[model samples]
Target: MSGNSRYRILFAGTPDTAVPSLDALVGAGFTIAAVLTRPDALVGRKRVLTPSPVAARAAELGLPILRASRLTGDAGRETLGRIAALDLDAAAVVAYGALVPAAGLEMPRHGWVNLHFSLLPAYRGAAPVQHAVIDQAAQTGACVFQLEEGLDTGPVFSRLERDLQPGETSGAVLADLAVSGAELLANTMGAILTGTATAEPQRGEPSLAPKLNQADGFVDAARPAAAVAARINGTTPEPGAWALLEMASAPAEEAGERPAQQRVKLLGAVPEELPEGTADLPLGDPLPGHLHRGRTAVHLQCADGTVRLVQVQPAGKKPMSAADWARGLPEGTRFQAEATAETATEGP
Candidate 1:
């Protein structure tokens, strides 16, 4: 809005990440009438009725709250009723899991706007942050756009881009983006109120970022080191990237053609430098399952080359240095190959 005007805002979002945007809008002089967040639900092992971080912050700011399941039927009608009653100029959504219906989207005098995690027309979906890392993107950023019917198909209003660092995790990237986007949201709303914000249609090829799951963790060893590293960092602290490794000494007969016990999650890695004198092994020669070092590094042979595992978290174990896990590995153990491998052999 202009320096002279402050728009009445109805805010919707559910996580701590959304807090900065909400607060920035308020700080930028927008009048936040009400906040719509999901109802309290069980989270974590305790199954406690945990309030959303956004809701808690809203309460502190003394704004009214509407905890609804969605904007459809009773829930939708109820939310719409509240919005109409608020007489808001517009609504701002940031990572709000619930869908905004057409009626709901049009409730405010102006219209709804969203603070999305990625540049529009790219990484448009539920898990954009994770996907960018998985794809080994060179860069990614946040965008503010007009809310539309299709998922993140909104018209762009403003954007802030950043380079993707080699060691950055999705969680870290999102944390920074949320803060940056929050400030941008405030600025955009300010401009809209003042009639300075300009809207533009999204350009470039659109990409999808589907919700990540446990199975998304499987990464082929045949992929390049850079790609593998990106996947490992992108899926951290959640549905992590993993690959199968079989013990080397297991009977070739029992292992069939390929030997592998199960999948192992990769948490951290660094590229290994080729030795000076020895000839570099081809992708298929040494195979992918060989645990290269006794400890400190996992020298798994992959498609393009080898990757050293710096840290890892096996299915049930806590995350630890790969060196520690190596020492803890059972003696006389043999590494197994990927399920797709035709022949598994113990590394000499």
Candidate 2:
């Protein structure tokens, strides 16, 4: 790394978002020792074998690739030997799914670095962007950290912050942070090559960002509208916010054992106040998820207030505006209040 030649960097990544970091390092004139990516997998409609996004990019760049399915046991040692053979100055990981065993971590003289989304010690795990938006964080960013034995528990070299704009979806926030973090990672590498960068142990209240799943996207009506709105924002374009609206007015014959409720995925929503008298209600209003139909928009009473639906997708149908979904609903239909609310907190 101290030589006159360009620093040799081993890049490990799998997804599309991680491509920017690779590009940044290459654009900054770093000689990528080799690219490490996940093995090809069956993807899409026909289930054809397809390379990961990073792998595709590495192919385009004509970089050497190390396809790893597991980085443990004999495989880990083989990967370590490969790293040693490369004589890498350092290795950078961005959303590399597999764990980097200690052998791989210690192989690079300059150490293994990770470009993690979210300011470290907070939202540190697989799904930081989703958790940040779910927690309604005003601002979140990226950090470059030395990958150690712990899960994202490492010394931080640099940090960059991005504002969480109003109604921004998790996907949008991640996209923005990817670009900034890619730039930060490249700069951090440049500084390290010059022996100017320093890393300190992470501080503050640490929180876990566990992987998000379909269950995490449920919009439980028993919770306040803002909380439901958070789910919509955080879950968009993935396991999108889903709920079951009850058709109270529909006859049993019409329903015909249709499970009483219809499933809907919320693509867009805005937490807002219920109109006029509906907001006041009785002191102990019993119906929390009562549907309130409007001419142009659809409003529904919630635990604390109401939510105006923007866009949604019903089961077996294409995505459509909330107003359109509401128009198709039977009269006096409402979303059933969740029997039990999710007790999990987003983050510290």
Best by TM-score: 2
The candidate 1 region of ten consecutive residues with least summed lDDT is 339-348
Residues 150-261, candidate 2: write the lDDT tens digits: 9999999999988886577888888888898999999998787789999999999999999989989988777777777788889886667888887764457476754377
Model 2 is weakest, by summed lDDT over 10 consecutive residues, at 339-348
Candidate 2 regions exceeding 4 Å error are: 1-5, 253-259, 275-286, 340-348
Local accuracy of candidate 1 as per-residue lDDT tens digits, 63-173: 899998788997679778978899889889998888888887777887898999998799999889899987878889999999988899988999999998886778788
Per-model C-alpha lDDT, please?
0.77, 0.83
Candidate 1 runs further than 4 Å off: 1-5, 245-263, 271-285, 331-348
lDDT of 2 at 203: 90
RMSD, one per candidate, in order: 4.4, 4.0
**In model 1, what is the error at residue 19, expressed in angstroms?**
2.1
Q: Pick the candidate with the highest lDDT.
A: 2
